[model samples]
Target chain A: MLVIVMTSIDPLTLVLAIGTPLYLAAAVLYSIRAVRGPTIPDIILAVDCLSYDLAVFLSAIALYYKTPFMTAPPIMLALWVYLLDIYASKYLITREVGV
Target chain B: MIEQVLFWTGSALFIIGGVFDLLGSIGLLRFPSFYVRLHAATIGAIYGAVLPLIGISLIALGSPGIPGNYTIAGASFVTALILLVVAPMGSHVLAHAAHKSKSVSWKPFVDMLEEDEEK
Candidate 1:
């Protein structure tokens, strides 16, 4: 007879287990706001939150998989989202992309 | 001992970040206006995202089981720092744009910017 007993869980695993679901829930709520928001700023705000959250999630996933190369994407995503904010605001204010 | 300390501390931070994320998202959904929702987005950005990235960095540093733990830690830490700086700037720019464009529907009692503009 073979018996497998699970005694202890890895701390990182435990943290990931508890944290990921919460992030997912937050993402879903933000998505709802993005869809239903009446104004463009409201939608942009929701997307901003979503992208930041996604960066966190991606980093955590990279840690989980022990893939160091994967960490690069989160930083890129964050930078690009910042660009999105700047470009969108520029367009909103000037009503044109080029000044 | 150090590994254990890092692991536990990181875990605690990770959990707190998760709670903040949930709260911020709820606030985003329930807030009455776009301007008000900016507060919620700030919460989500600083508390929910940056904190967890820092926590992930700590966890990566502590976990010797991860193959390239140093790389993961460094990357996450840099990402957190970038987010800390970028998030608020983005929020400020967006709010300014929204206000200038008069995209906000709700009127505040103060209207300091409008008053200044008029003067």
Candidate 2:
């Protein structure tokens, strides 16, 4: 199966080859920012970006694999990050007041 | 012939989006402030995520080997749209909170928000 899949110069192959490395590089940068971030919001923002990136990567994989089910992960992740943003902000604001 | 067009277009988009994402991440690492970093992150989330998903969808739709490729493409489209909507909103929420809480000193030249709050 792998051999058959690799035999063709498919668009999916091209996308995966070009995109995966770039995403990995971005992830590394995000990790660096998360560790070195001076402020809470900065770290949270990095994490949020990372999650969204993950979703996008998943979407790309779904396309490459031609699996509709794979798309669901990206959708769930995108929505999840939004909620994280809200709650994180709420926590940041409230934590200051001793609440 | 149509598939060839789509395949080439998708490949181009994928490469372009990858470049943007890498640039955004570099900016995130190099930027001076939290707000600037937020800007970079927005670029990553928006251009980085959306464009590539679009490319992937196009590829899926064009590739004959994948079964139910249209369904996969539709899913990618929906995911990309959702990312487009949500990413900026998330950035806004984070930036607003950061500003309000004084988590990071922005020190913008205009200071409109500060003036408005004062008034």
Candidate 3:
């Protein structure tokens, strides 16, 4: 009885737990958009959104786990996304010629 | 005791919101045009990501057993607020960017961005 009670997730933890999978789903959706977007800006924007999302989702998971370590991956995720956006924007400006 | 109830309720909201978000994604995949796809993306972020974040906060806030310092609930709640404010702005930025870039043309309808572009 003690083991069952202690080991079972409290209702709140269960709630926090669901966020990881949902983040996974959203990440996939954003990726799909990034891949399939017809234009340069669309893809860049999708990538941007995905990166921001990974950051926030990572933070949330960190809170759930009560761990400071969960924070690191998202910071890196955001940096990578920002880098991609700058690259994509520069490419769009130079390559896409005209009205 | 109360935490258990609140957690379940928040989770239910999260699931419902997720479904709405999923619907929005499907709309994006299925929609015929860019403008329409914009609608799907915006709605998905709003309904799916933002709403679930709020639900998670509620669950955290309501959960018991944390000492009175309020860090657990407070931080989680703050996270929801940030998402709520930022999500819409992000949507607006993407939609505006997409509209202004003149990358995709809408079909069989009146278009304002085009008018602006023409000027």
Candidate 4:
């Protein structure tokens, strides 16, 4: 997908060219925090940051491809992260997520 | 003319958001403590995710090549909307959970929550 976006010489192409690498770099930094984090919550925070970034990256890809259907991924990604946060918080508070 | 303007606007937003994403990520790496890293992560979630979604939606809405359907634009809008609503709340929950679990210490310079927790 990125290759296709990069081959084109349009404004949207420019946006994707710049955005893709930046998002990847963010993910790298988040991963570092996740792996080296001193506490479980710190690792969870890194993952939360990483997922949000993935949603943004997906939106950029959708724009580059001009595919509306692609937008669905970001929505689902955000929703999933939110669910993760809820369960994580539940676990942190009570050590159980009720299932 | 309008399309060009919208495209450039979207481009600008994407650029700014990308810069923020990079900075936030660097902050995540450099911060001294878990709470500080959380601050950096929150910045990435809100600015990095939301702005680019809006920018992409604008580009999608204005471009002629990619179908430019209203549903597509609407989907991007919804994604951005959901991110805006969810990111902060998720961060807050994580912070609360971290505090409650004693997974990370509250070592801020002021330490207000520390006193409240004791009370």
| Candidates sorted on TM-score, descending | 1, 2, 4, 3
> Which candidate number has the best DockQ?
2
Per-candidate TM-score, first chain only? Answer: 0.86, 0.79, 0.64, 0.81
Query: Where in model 4 is the C-alpha error above 4 Å?
Result: A1-9, B106-110
Off by over 4 Å in 3: A1-9, A12-22, A48-56, A67-99, B66-69, B116-119
As for candidate 4, its clashing pairs are none
Q: Give the per-residue lDDT digits (tens) of candidate 4, residues A3-91.
A: 65556677666568876888898899889988998887778888888988888787777766666676677788887787777887899
On TM-score, the candidate that comes out on top is 1
Candidate 4 per-residue C-alpha lDDT over B1-119 given as tens digits, one digit per residue, 9 for 90 to 100: 88888878877887888889889989988998877777888789778888877877777767766654466667877988888888888888988888778877655668677689899
Best-first order by lDDT: 1, 2, 4, 3
lDDT of 1 by residue, B16-116 (tens): 99999999999999999988899999999999999999998888878877678899999999999999999999999999999898877986888888889
Q: Write the per-residue lDDT of candidate 3 for residues B1-119, one digit (tens) a residue.
A: 67667767767866666666667666666776766666776666567656665565555556544333145445545554555565555555545655655565666567776688789
Q: Candidate 1 - CAPRI tier?
A: medium
DockQ of each: 0.56, 0.66, 0.24, 0.57
Clashes of each: 0, 0, 0, 0
Give the lowest summed-lDDT range of ten residues in model 3 chain A: A90-99
Per-residue accuracy of model 3 over A1-99 as CA lDDT, tens digit each:
445545666655665566556667767887898799877656665665565555556546655665434444544453344454444444444555332
Looking at model 4 chain B, which ten-residue stretch has the lowest summed lDDT?
A: B64-73
Give, for candidate 1 chain A, the lowest lDDT window spanning 10 residues. A1-10
lDDT of 2 at A97: 35
Say which docking band candidate 4 falls in.
Answer: medium
Say which docking band candidate 2 falls in.
medium
List the candidates' TM-scores in order.
0.94, 0.90, 0.68, 0.89
